[model samples]
Target: MPDTQLRPLRAFAESLRLDQVNLTERWMRAVFHDTELSDADRLTYEQLSDHIPAILEEICGALEEQDLDQVEPAIERNARKHGKLRWRQGYRIDELVRELDLFRQMLAGQIVQFSESRPFFTRRHEERARHFIDEAVSFVTLTSIREVLTERDRKIDEYTGRLERANHELTLKQRLVGDLYESRMQITRSVVHDLRNFLNVFSMALQLMSRAPAKVEAALALANRQAADMKALVDELVEYSVVLGDNHQAAVECFDLRGLFDELVASCSPAVEAKGLRLTAAFDDTLSTIVSNRLKLKQVALNLLTNAAKYTKVGQVELAMTAAGEDQWRLRVSDTGVGIGASDRERVFKEFERATGDDIPGAGLGLAIVRELTRVLGGQIRFDSNEGEGTSFEITFPVRLEAREGGEGGPA
Candidate 1:
């Protein structure tokens, strides 16, 4: 309060400014040795200082001018920053408190050491400096803890909301699972019924051929056609079975992602050219090697490209591959021919289903295989179609597949 009271404190504050850098270094050295503050080791020299030099300047300003208002903003700003940074570095509350307390003790020691060296420095001057340091530390400590706790509360709220939303989604997924089970059972029944019908026709043709050798030619032809159809059906079903199996992941490899997609494009190029449709492919410049099931992914791209070519009467089949997000990639196969009918979209991925009708070749298992492979490779498949314009099947998957999803112990 008195001019004499302010003089020694101001002189000490000035002296502290001169040795500010050294003071910060000493504080950091003490912090590094403290067993309770392990997280401090992760911080660089600049970070560990926690802006102590700035805070000291503020303390000195307050002491010299004998006014706390001038330095309050600067101190509080530094404190908030320090707290937020420490929280991000994964420091616990106790560790934060202990670290700051160490800085406080260091400043307290500085005050005592300075007082001992100078004859003009008295107990009153020591009291004044100590009080200023104490006041500044309190402001910083409370503000910093508030910032950390506020951040913690916000994140907790966010996680809680996410959990609630996830729970609701899980419930919907369970219901969808039940529906899928029923749908699978229906597909099984449908396949069995078709097999039975084929067998009956084959039996009738055989009977006709045996009863009357005069008409054997027509009956034999019918029997042969029936046998071929049966074989084709069995073959496709075998393929479908293998594709839907869990073994697709056994082919996981970390290879050039663009190289594989480009290779797939090349594989389908001849066919696409034969159809008089341009086979165009676009890739992100950042496309690089990725970890995933290569063979299964190749199959997906091949099937999609083939179908795109098959369905397109004119225009081009386009393949676009790019990064979808920080850790995901997107591949889209689009056609410029007759797109899938809106009503038929639901059954497009169904076993023995075809949206473009019976004009195309092969069993309707192509799309089904694509869907299963997408699932096996941890991806989502969705199509955008305008009945006459075209259909684009876009699938987004992780850039790096986890070991379990990549089939652990399988060939990489």
Candidate 2:
């Protein structure tokens, strides 16, 4: 039998143990009454209420057993559930802890009310009840703190991952911007160099017109041609600046390849001859008219021929076109001039870069422009050179458009 003095404590514990569901439900209703919450938050609060009965039962058992450990699993479960759900619901840790504090306060109030209604419940019982409630609250507080820390660590990890990805993308963009800036600088230098070459030609033509009355027509023609060439260069600069990968294929047309070569040779041969250098053109028997960008091809050929004539002081400069395969053609320009050195070969194709070891009169743009045009034509260039002998450049391109046969063996 239970002692009469402890009777109230036992009876009170039994009441709470038996009526766990009603006690928890009433406490939750009172706590939630008149509280404004979002639908999601209210649903979470309702769900949490369902676990309260079991928690109250555990607390009652701990009071009977006088062992706080008996209530630990319940406290741990409640804390973990509240912590995780509130986190996902975007609630603050303090808010979740405050609700748990309210539950502890209500449990303490119920115990005090039960003791007050019974005179047999002593000061000793009251002290023990207060201590038990304090332990329960302390345990819950510790678990809530642990859960908040764990959640903080998880969020830190998530934020760290996003930051790393952003950093990588930023680095890649910086590298691309640096490369683009360097390319623009090179282009600017090349344009300035080409403009100066046009100025020199105009200056020479003016001098000739002023010196010789008989050369008036020839000087005017040279000036007109140089002016047209300068206009073309300006137009090309505009096109290149507007967009990348605009290969300018919109101007593509079918023209006689032989005719293009013949016209270019006739126009360029005089310059080479004036320098006392022989210029020869050779066309393969299988070569004929084809479909391509006529203006760009002519520009490439003219640049190559002019470059050869400018460099070569003696011996022959030759231009040749041959069928490399059924759908491939090669245009080659060989010059018996001051060839590029092995170490300087890489620099020769760069804008405003010239061959070494010679005082050549040039703006150093001819080969660079040729390289750019050849690339736009989807062609690759190869060079063979010896220091004293000569240099040969071969460009090969695949025919995208179907070819129509027209020309036979001819002096291109």
Model 1, global lDDT: 0.83
Instruction: List, residue by residue over 220-251, the lDDT tens digit for candidate 1.
Output: 88888777767766776787777656653355
lDDT of 2 by residue, 262-322 (tens): 8978998888899899988998877776766777678788878877887789998999989
Give the clashing pairs for model 1: none
lDDT of each: 0.83, 0.73
lDDT of 1 at 38: 89
TM-scores for all predictions: 0.51, 0.51
lDDT for model 2 comes to: 0.73
**What is the RMSD, in Å, between candidate 2 and the native fold over all Cα?**
10.3
